[model samples]
Target: MGGFELTLDTLRDLAEGAAVLGTGGGGDPYVGRLLVEQQLRAGRAVRIIGVDELPDDALVLPCALMGAPTVFHEKLPGAAGIVTALRTLEDRLGRRAAATMPIECGGFNSMIPLVLGAETGLPVVDADGMGRAFPELQMETFAVMGVPGSPMSIASDHGDAGIIDAVDNRRMEMLARAVTVQMGGSAYICDYPMDAREVRRTAVPGTLTLAARIGATLRQARDDHRDPFAALTAMLADTIYSHGVVLFRGKVADIERRTVAGFARGRVRLTAMDDPGDQMEIVFQNEHLVARRNGQPAAIVPDLICTLNSETGAPVTTEALTYGQRLTVYAISTPRIMRSPEALACFGPAGFGLDDPYVPVEQLVGGP
Candidate 1:
């Protein structure tokens, strides 16, 4: 298949699938779905091209919304913000962006670039830096592969915009976070400019298609009166992820959420509905980092820890968690690229202030 024009129906599927990949972070896909739906209704075309099909010299820009996901719930951005950021970056680099791609394939970031592409008349490359969502900008495959994250542009819905030329990816994230907070907790950014060759090497291939396929699989399972979770696991195991399973099934008992240092920091406690004494806890700094059951680590970062509504099989975002909600937690292995020593150092449990050693989700779950 070459590429296809994005429609409202496909966007809804992408949003649902992205929320599952988001690992309880990357902002709300519902908001993203609404934004992209608006663009489609306005007669704009958003096309998704496979990354391998991009010209070797094509200029690709990765764009996303940055900051606390909670903030986005209250403050919606004007489409102009993403346009401004992309245009600002293009002007700064003295070259036009040939295509746009998502910085991450999970949550709102997966769909945000589609909106930009539709608005800017640029096709979106069907790939992303993180096959899943990550809290920090530096924790992407692009950064892990030595791609510079500088010469970036950030813009707010209020017509404020700024450019950053950082020495490194970490500095880029630090600087951007400050600006994001000042912009009322969220902003749009275009960063990690690269040629098609670099994109092919650093990005997770076909993630946009993967997200869509996942959504379609789940929808079909639900419609056929089959077990959606079983179908989801089968689909994930057939992909680069290679492993997927429900780690816990319970009802939320307590939740502690706070905006700390410009990030949504929180923990969720769940009690097993079948066994009240059995409990599971998930910790997060935007994206889920660790999950423990009865104080024993069940899953750790670099691997995906996702929450789904038990009854509906719908993905749930961290900021949307509420007490007494029935949910099932799934643990899927990270892409092989993300499990490398270098990549782990950047986004593992230690990176999130957890002293736990990195463990594969399959190992923790006693094989898939």
Candidate 2:
């Protein structure tokens, strides 16, 4: 992404790619994509940099949208929610942001920072706290490296702002989630506050650039009538599960939901496309937790479970699941950063209230 001049086309490509990497979580990037497009249209300047370019003492934080994916469908967040959080965080930290970074690789969070950076003239860092998406604040590369998750600043659309300082990331997830739910199911979080030194050591390098590249690749492939699934597979180590249906064709057969101590937890079941005799189940705790065929687990926690529109192969979020429609269920292994004990400890099945064995997804999938 060298010395690139910002443009709407570029942001659109980035958003599309982020959607692919979102792996069925991070909410839809459509609104965020449009939001960034508007900023680019307004002639904003945005710079993207590799984390390697960061100063040793810099305070780099990863921030993103957080809330019930359900509410996201009903009340589209006022697009400025992210910038609001950045401003609120700066006010409390008593410092200007040196660089802005994405908390995860999903479309919305990854692209939102570009617009914020454009407006603030802060360079968007190339790396992210997570190379892929995870359900909770505690389940990031920063956590794997032992950087604390709190002293995080959260901002809401109602002009409400506060600092989240917790005993740990789990506590932070719980506390921030409580406040965010009260604030209307979602808010922005600036967390994993780290100096440039830690950022260099822990963060996934070139994730932002990688996101743009992925977006571009997908777009190019589609235009050329190439297989997007093949391109996606080459881009990351993930599995693709699909039929031929588009986004609007899927049906939600069953949903089992529960709120355990503030975290939204549940599973959704869908009957097969052509045969009701077959079935699929998607488990989630804030994000897609697991997927299964018949009674055997097909995809599990720590493994990416992205539901793609069958025709397009784009990622799908839990919030988007519906009844009886055909859909592609992808299962990608967790990024290396998320495979660590600490990362898994926070988001593994146990964290989501399951007693299943904690096994690396690769181990479960065998090879290729």
Candidate 3:
């Protein structure tokens, strides 16, 4: 084991890093960050285990909060939420949760386990289920690899708990979302329990580490007066990935949203500052799924669609996006894990009502 501790410094770094990579989906870092920091102050240890070191027999679980990405502002679940989920799930499985993995690479997902780790005794893995947030829970790597979403468990702030078992991963996500709404718009969940064998095949390897790197680079670049986006572009280029320019920089001009299909389906309009006549609309189901430039298809699923602040350029979560908020639309290639034929089937064009061709972000960006 390289290390068996989650330090304050590391937690701060992770929080900042996660926020930058949230890709306009995961909840903000400040809320989850403060929660986890408080727990650490109380003296807790979160561990990290290399994916290869996980025992084939050991059971791995991904921990996270589930619900409308919007609920955080009205009724904060408070810091105790994550520990409640972790402990409850540990008991349900009747086995000690060997280690913890983030469900996604974004702010809240990475921070949830850290907060719980201080209250409970589980260590956070240097990994996550999804490299980035997907609108649906089933969009995680676990689902892409056919890992069952249950037997899973969730806990709400009201002390209500539920054990979920579904026939398929998508059904499980739908069931869980409905239950979360009833629990006041959010529920803490511990799911995707699988043996190390399955974990090795499905989970994005070293995603937490990757997030940390991206996070650190952004900060360092900013200090050097180097463009953060340009630095990100270079990093992706080094990896043979492609990225697009500032699509439109302005404030949200309008929003049309509804709670349907057990998910938040909405459209947010961004008024352009550079091009006064141009406007962009972002359509999402939990994560940003599509982008429209002046009512025409700009990018759709299978390609990574994300939005960020005009100046900060950090992620702008679906929940946080609203009218009068300055922003910039962006695109990047999907993680290789998500580009597979099987992956495209679930989260690609058809999944999001995208009628146009699902071009790779690289191709759309005019390639490397």
Candidate 4:
């Protein structure tokens, strides 16, 4: 599909797909769904355009909610906050955005751009920086491809806002994160303002549509009484992701999570539903970073590690994971663009303070 209008009929699919891509991070997709639905009900429109459809020099500003997902559950970002930040960035650059795009294809971040599109009457790009979510602001394909995150703007629902101009993307993350904390743990941001030419080369292509497909696939499978996991893996085999595997099926045994450093940092332990001795542990910083099963790495960063409800095939975000929840943890390989040397250096295991080297999820999991 080249482009399409987002209507109330398709909004749920996009939200569900985004939550799966979130990989147990990003904010709550259900909350995001409600937010976007609210806009559609208000008679606004969200038009999504594919990467190839973008004009070469048209300005495309990426926007998202940056903060702890746990905090987001208690507070919702207002449409005005997002618009305020986008306008701030636009004012600094002296260019009105031809389109808005998602920084990541996860939960609230994915839908926030759609909300912006509906609110401002600008088309939302059907692509994103990280094909999935990552905690740090600089951990995006845009930054890896040399797009600076500066001239970034942050705004809160209460009307507070500021722009950050930093020498490097990392410094930009630090400064913006500090501002996010002051704004009460969560805030909306517009950053990496680049023309469509840069976006076509740097962003993960067609992820918004891909996310919608994922959501639709799960829904269809469930409606048909088919195995949603099997259906999901089969569908992913045909995408840029290439491979998907159900790494483990278990119940949440323990969870130790905390909001720290402007991120939801923690680890969750799960025990096999049938085998008490078989266990797995997944760690995260706003996003699932790694998964280890029986003391061996099952999935590592740069790949997608996600948790889904065992029965409904619905994704469960990190903030919502709780003890005794039955879940099917799965991993999908990221596209080659995300595995380049520079990309790995930005979001690889080392980036999250892990000693293990980056490993493709298929190699680690013995995929279907």
Cα lDDT of candidate 3 equals: 0.72
Which ranges in model 4 have alpha carbons more than 4 Å from their true place?
none
Error of 4 at 294 (Å): 1.2
Q: TM-scores for all candidates?
A: 0.98, 0.87, 0.90, 0.98
In angstroms, the error of model 3 at 288 is 0.8
Residue 92 in model 2: lDDT: 72
CA deviation > 4 Å runs, candidate 1: none
Runs in model 3 with CA error above 4 Å?
1-5, 239-245, 258-262
Kindly report which residue stretches of model 2 are placed more than 4 angstroms away from their true locations once superposed. Answer: 1-6, 79-81, 237-265, 272-276, 366-368
| Model 3 C-alpha lDDT per residue in residues 164-270, reported as the tens digit of each score | 88888888888998888788888889888887788888887766666666666667777787877777667666442245455556778898876664456788988
Q: What is the lDDT, from 0 to 100, of the residue 358 in candidate 2? A: 68
lDDT tens per residue, model 4, 1-368? 47898877688998999999999999877877787899989888789998678779999999998999999878877788899999989999988999999999977799889888888999999889999999888999999999999989999989888889999999999998898999999899999999999998899988998899899999999999999989999999889998999999999999999999899999999999889899999999888998999889999988989999999889998889999999999898999999999999999987888999998988776767
What tens-digit string does per-residue lDDT give for candidate 2 at 1-368? 35455577777777766775676667778888777777777878788877667778887767788875556666676546677788777777787778888888774677667767876788888778767666678877778788987788888887888898799888998898889888887787788877878888888777666666667766777888887666766666431211111111234688776555434577888776667767777777656776766776766776666677666665566666665545766666655666666766766777677767666555555544
Cα RMSD for candidates in order = 1.0, 4.0, 2.6, 0.9
* Alpha-carbon local distance difference test for all models: 0.90, 0.70, 0.72, 0.90
For candidate 1, lDDT tens digit of each residue in 1-368?
38998988788889999998999998888878888898899999999998777789999999999988888888986689999999999999999999999999999899889889889899999989998998899988999999999999999998888899999999999999999988889999999999999998998888998899889888888889888889988998778988988999999999999998778899999999989999999999888989999999999999999999887688888999999999999888888989899888888877777899998988888754
- As a TM-score, model 4 comes out at 0.98
